[model samples]
Structures are given as structure tokens and as C-alpha cells.
Target: MTIFTLSLFSNPLYSQVAVIVHATNQQALTESDIKNLFTGKLKSFPDGNPVIVLNLPEGDPNQSLFNQKVLGRSDAQVKAFWSKLMFTGKGTPPKEVTAEEMIKLVSENPSTIGIVDSAAVSDKVRVLIQH
Candidate 1:
């Protein structure tokens, strides 16, 4: 029999995740920028291109963390917020997607921004911000 050791620290999945956007998006985004984009406050990038915000499905761990830490809203709060906006005809909610789907969407659309675990980042996508 052989014994193997695996350190938690060595696991890449255990590493901290970085919030990313397309590098072509020259606008340096602050935490507020990210929040505003997702919440539909700021619709255009600094250069005036339409900005698209992608989000994970509700109840996802990363989505929950991102909502709490980045957007400063609980699941219910976000729901209510979107409801108000939609009913008012002011704005539409961001596109919701699975973690895997978001990765593909953000990468393919330069105007789109989405959050993903750092471990999932690939050469096909540009990681503009890591927060």
C-alpha cells in the first residue's frame, strides 16, 4: 500500500478568485463600477460602448458571495430591485446564466462582463480585473 498527501494549500481550487472583465475594456473599474454595471446603473463603458453584465444563477455560492461582497445585496434584495426596475420599465435585469454558460458568454462578447472563479479562467478570455 502507498500513502499520498495532498495539501489544501496546494489545491488551485482553494485559491482566491478574481473578478474579471475583458481587457479591451479600457475603463478601469472600481468596486462601484462593477456594482453599477450589474445593477444597471451605468450602462456604458467610459468609451461609450454598451456594457453587458452577466451573472450566475441565484443560489450559486459564487453568485451569493459576489452579490454580498460586490453588489451589497441579498438574493431577495436583488430580486426586489430587479422587480421594481422591470415593472417601472426603467431597465431589464442582467442576463442570468450557469457558471459554465457565463464563462462562455463573457469570453465571446467583448462588451460583456462577468465574474468567475480564477481557476476557471482560460487563454480564450481576458481577465481585466481581479478583485
Candidate 2:
């Protein structure tokens, strides 16, 4: 079980991360929009609908890759950034969730967005962008 779990996390096939929203959502979000949403900078869709952003736990493989490729920062840096924002009463980081929950919430809520491994994506959620 330990080896299986380790191999799952280390697999290159799952290295690609996908940002997803509700399947019926038609929002066209750019990379900057994604970065801002994840960073607590942008809170709404172009239509002015507020979003509920979800993230995988800190250090999760997909989360780490998303941070590097999309956010252009390390996981620790992201944690620190949120910490400072919270301390200064400026922002709140997205909620941390498992990959399964990400899919569940995003699929169920049109106003929600979240990340998951590219391979884990199902028809339940719509892919906004991948990184």
C-alpha cells in the first residue's frame, strides 16, 4: 500500500494538473485569471459571479505542480503569502481539499472552481485550463 501510494504521487503521467469548474459553465478564463483566483486576487467570474476556489492540500503533487506552473511560486511561498494576507486582514486562501472533493464540489457548484490531476478529470467537471 505504501509503495502504491508513493508511486501514485511520483508518477509523471499525473504531473499535469487541470483547473476545473462546473460542467455547464461557459466561462473563458485566461492564465492570469486562474492565477489571480488561486492567489486570492480575483474573486469573481467576468460576469461578476463570485467563485469558491478550492485547492489540494499543501505539498500534494498536483497542487505543487499547479503552484509552480501556474502561480509561479513554491508551495511554501504560497503558504507564506496567504499567511501574510491573513495576518494583514487582506485575504483568505482557498480551502484545501482532497482531489476527490475538488471534483465533487466543482461538479456540484457552478460558482466553484478547483484543481485536480489531469488524469483524474471526469465528465462531471469542465476543464477551464491545464498546467
Local distance difference test values of all predictions, in order: 0.76, 0.92
lDDT of 1 by residue, 1-131 (tens): 22333656454435444566664555677778778898999998778889888888877767766777777888889989999999999999888887788777876778888878777887657775553
Q: How many times do residue backbones clash in model 1?
A: 0
**Pick by TM-score: which candidate is best?**
2
Compared with the true structure, the alpha-carbon lDDT of candidate 2 equals 0.92
lDDT of 2 at 123: 98
Best by lDDT: 2
List model 2 lDDT by residue over 26-124, tens digit each. 999999999999998999998999999999998898899999999999989999999999999999999999988899999899999999999899999
